[model samples]
Target: MRRGGAETETDDPTEDYDDTHADGEAVTEGAGARRARLRRGRRDSAWTRALESRRVRIGVAAGVVVALAVALVAYFSPLLSVRTVEVEGISAITDQQVQEALRVPEGRSMLRLDTDAMAQRVSELPKARSVRVQRVFPSTVRVTVEERTPVLYFEAPDGAHLIDSDSVEFAIEPAPIGVPKLVTEHPGGYDAVTRAAVTVMAAVPPALRLEVGQIAARSVSDIRLELRDGKTVLWGGATDSERKAAVVVPLLGQPGEVFDISSPNLVTVK
Candidate 1:
């Protein structure tokens, strides 16, 4: 009993576990916190070093400056200059004519080329119905042209004047194939009968136009068509040209020497 004065070590398992577990958890948490601080310290030191160095800041700024300078040189210098002028969609006019109209200088920067001015210049060509001008990147300028197509032709003292759908006399050469001749007392652009005849011609389908030999108009209201054969068509005026053209084609197939479509809604064949 006298030995009780000295405290003896207990054999209980939970006591040893409780005491050691707390110490172990505390040690693990301290180590983890120290590791995280070390990582943050390393990152902050690297950032501070970079901020303190004038060369680093200058290097980034110089890189941005160099990139911008390169871009400026590429845009203004001859590196991205136009080296070729390309013309497309031409049958009556030559490429040389279009290129001359463009008049863009060689080695001119594509960015500096005025596309609208170029298109306007090309549109001055009588044969050009529509024109588009654009810069083909890196070395070329492209000119796209839509040439006027002749719907009819009229004989003049000089030559055969080709008339397009809009009554414009675009060219004065031999009439193209399948183009019907226009016969009017005054067969010029300003003539009312000629314009009526042209309107009738423009409304006729391509296949029907091929079968037609001549179109005659006395006044704006009196128009006629002479087929390749001896058949005749009495078409009315420019007002109902579209409907007359539509009715006359099917009426021609009927057994008749004359087809009258003056009133398209009431057609007659004789």
Candidate 2:
């Protein structure tokens, strides 16, 4: 092949074409491999994303289940049950009476207590004017009661009937001091004269009320007040009671045996 002094090319015309063809094939294969690698990379990334999303969903569902279980345990378990009942504002009615009325069983869950129903039950007691029942956390139920006050009292065959400012006959207990005695033909709310007497008594000021020993009503229009000092007052009726109450106070100083402020506009002291 190198017969001449200057190097002469070999007579292999297909060699250059073959080398070029092989190089082209190598480049095509490399490009195809690169494309395969890219596709694999994309598939791997998509699979990873799907796996992460599925894990998050599973985690959320598990958390919800755990929370619900905890809630159920808190709601029904005896760990948060009531062990004691605390009563407040109770004087007329004994704590044992109120507790009996409540009827809440031992070991009842605080969260499961029907507070409204309990309060309603306790209020059934005549002396309990208003009641509040609540759970005092882990182990106690609290009951707050506002007892009825005796504004006036009437004697009956059995005992004294106590009346409050609302004209309700609440109890038959002995009347407390400073409470006025009510006297009427028929001493009850059903009688108009009884209502009139209580209405007039309610209008009397606290200071003047202490001096009033007895209030009698013959009819709805004829109400009389007997003071502790053996003096009498013609209170007329339920009408203009506020004016009558205001006029009767100063009229007492006038050395009168009978004070007539029944018609406050035309008052007389005799």
Best candidate (score: lDDT): 2
Deviating ranges (above 4 Å) for candidate 2: 1-59
Model 1 residue 181 distance off true place after TM-score fit, in angstroms:
1.2
lDDT per residue as tens, model 2, 187-257? 98677788888788889877789999988889999989999999999999898888887888888999879
Cα shift from native, residue 165, model 2 (Å): 1.7
Task: Give TM per candidate.
Answer: 0.74, 0.77
Q: Report the Cα RMSD per candidate.
A: 7.6, 10.8
TM-score top scorer: 2
Worst 10 residues of 2 by lDDT: 13-22
User: TM-score of model 2 relative to the true fold?
Assistant: 0.77
Candidate 1 residues 1-270, lDDT tens each? 136698677664323222246447532345456667789999999988888797878999999999999888887898888888888899888998898898887776788888999999999999999999987788888888999998889898999999988888999999988888998878877878888888788788777888898898889898888989989998878787777767777788899898988998888888
